[model samples]
Target: MTSIIVFYLLYLLSLCLGLACVVCVCVWSGHWRGGFAWDGSALEFNWHPVLMVTGLVVVYGVGAVVYRIPLTWGQNKLPWKLLHAALMLIALILSIVGLCAVFDYHNINKISNVYSLHSWIGITATAVFAMQWVCGAAGFLLPCSPVTLRKVLKPVHVWLGGIILLLSIAACISGINEKLFFALKGNATGTQPYSSLPPEAVLGNTLGVLIVAFGLVVLKILSNHEWQRPDSRPEGLAYTPLLQEENE
Candidate 1:
């Protein structure tokens, strides 16, 4: 029972932190960064941050924890698996759109692309996430996948989920710092520098902290063995071998 309670508390905290990070990024980009547009302008670039936070971070994190939720233990695993796959698909699409938006903005403004540490990490994270999603869907969701194949892929999938999330968080932090450095040091009149702790800088910094906190909490919950779903099938449910092996 204590384990159950701890699971709930950690899950709720992670959810709240993820949501807060989304909100912070939206406000930082939409309210402070001249709002959003789609005409290959800086405004269009704002979509990159907002969608990345909403889809890649928040939605992806929620999907990762779907299987860990105690409330869903009594239900069939197939539905949960479908939900997880659906969420991942959505996240991938959103992240791709975010990437496109930034690339479009850069191209229109004649700026170089993929030249910074932030771009390298962010692109690599997104590519890895896409590959992970594709591999998971092919291995787990397909009817032709043999049981042995799933047994092999499950552990790899689980391990990669956490690693991809960490990569995303690192990318977010680096991107935030890179953007702040540019925004703060720009010759925009009346705008205070990062050293001045301006409102925009404060909000951007807070968004980075929220993203990190959310990732850490989710990772902690994922790593807690006491909170893992039990091997025993719930009452009235057909037997399932989802957790038959610890490595899986």
Candidate 2:
């Protein structure tokens, strides 16, 4: 019960943070700037934060915890695995679209691309996630794969997933800081810089905190062995010994 409570609480917190991130980006680009667009305008840049939050933060979070839901624990694992992969694929597609938008905007404006620490880490994380998904599908989802192979790869998959999540969060933080610094730097025409705690700065900083909190809560939930889903196979199964030994 305590695990369930904590899970739901963190789930709610993630939802709130997701909403806050959307609202912050919308306010910053729509209200404060001019509005959003896809035609290489400043508004086109707004899609970056919005889609990154949706894909990396929201959808990825759901994918990470899908197997932990109690309702899914009693069901056949294949369906759950398919659902997990589908959610991750959707997240990856969203992330690709977000990346395209940013790159297009940069190209249109003649700005250099992939030049920042945030871009470097973000691209690497995306590439690693794509590779992980492909390897997972080939190893675990294929019927021809041996059970031993699956068991051996399971731990690797879980750890890589967790690491990818952390990388995504780190990229997000650095991206936010980069954007905020750029905004502050461009405010030289004004009497007061963004150091004065403008509404946009406050919203950006809050979004960063919420993102970090969401990642930490997710890590905590994932690390709790008590909340892990149990294997659905019955006793006396051929793979039972392998799983038991691995668990031990």
Candidate 3:
């Protein structure tokens, strides 16, 4: 029961990260990109942006780990260990690639091709992430469940997360192979694909990037809260908190 509750909260947190990033970027874009064109120059490395991205990454990675850790103070193994592990690993990879994509565009102006890979990874990751949640909800009888429904829980979880993970890989491949934003004259001195992310995909990928990063930060905070009693989780997280806990 406790594990089930924790998983739901984790899902909420993941979603929060995604939606928050969308809002942040939309707000930032409105302010930052006015009439200004990306000039292939490196980002100025402002503290807030760095903190926002890094904090989210750490939070996400740790949460990923926590979701899959196989034991939760009982003799039995943690339920859905594989699903959690796979999802977390995928999230970590996507987050790293997202940072890379940011650099590729903001610094090298070599992102059209790079964005392909980044986009695929992100979509695939998100797909997998979403599936994980669905299976989890159904399996846990989340919100509420019938006794018979519980019988299919394990299979539902395994299958759903797995499908999402597989799709993410496909998305990853397709993303890296982008052909839509091919070469174009730079509006700001040398920015290729000056289109600033295709209108169709911009909302999805940009928001995905920011949200994943933000989610990581939130998880990291939960993991590192020192006042909470320390548990048997990992100790080396960048923003290590003793235990992963949440309510509702």
TM-score for each of the candidates = 0.92, 0.87, 0.32
The sequence of per-residue lDDT tens digits that candidate 3 reaches over residues 45-151 is: 12223332322243334444454332343322234344445545455454444445455455564334424555555545554565565555444524355445555
Candidate 1's C-alpha runs over 4 A off are 186-188, 232-248
Order the numbered candidates by TM-score, best leading: 1, 2, 3
lDDT of each: 0.84, 0.77, 0.43
Put down candidate 1 lDDT per residue, 94-199, tens digits, no spaces.
9999999999999999999999988898899899999999888777766666677777787899899999899889888998988898888646566788888898
Q: What is the lDDT of residue 96 in candidate 3?
A: 46
In model 2, the runs with Cα more than 4 Å from the true position are 186-192, 234-248
**Which of the two candidates, 1 or 2, achieves a greater TM-score against the reference?**
1
Candidate 2 residue pairs in backbone clash: none
lDDT of model 2 at position 106: 95
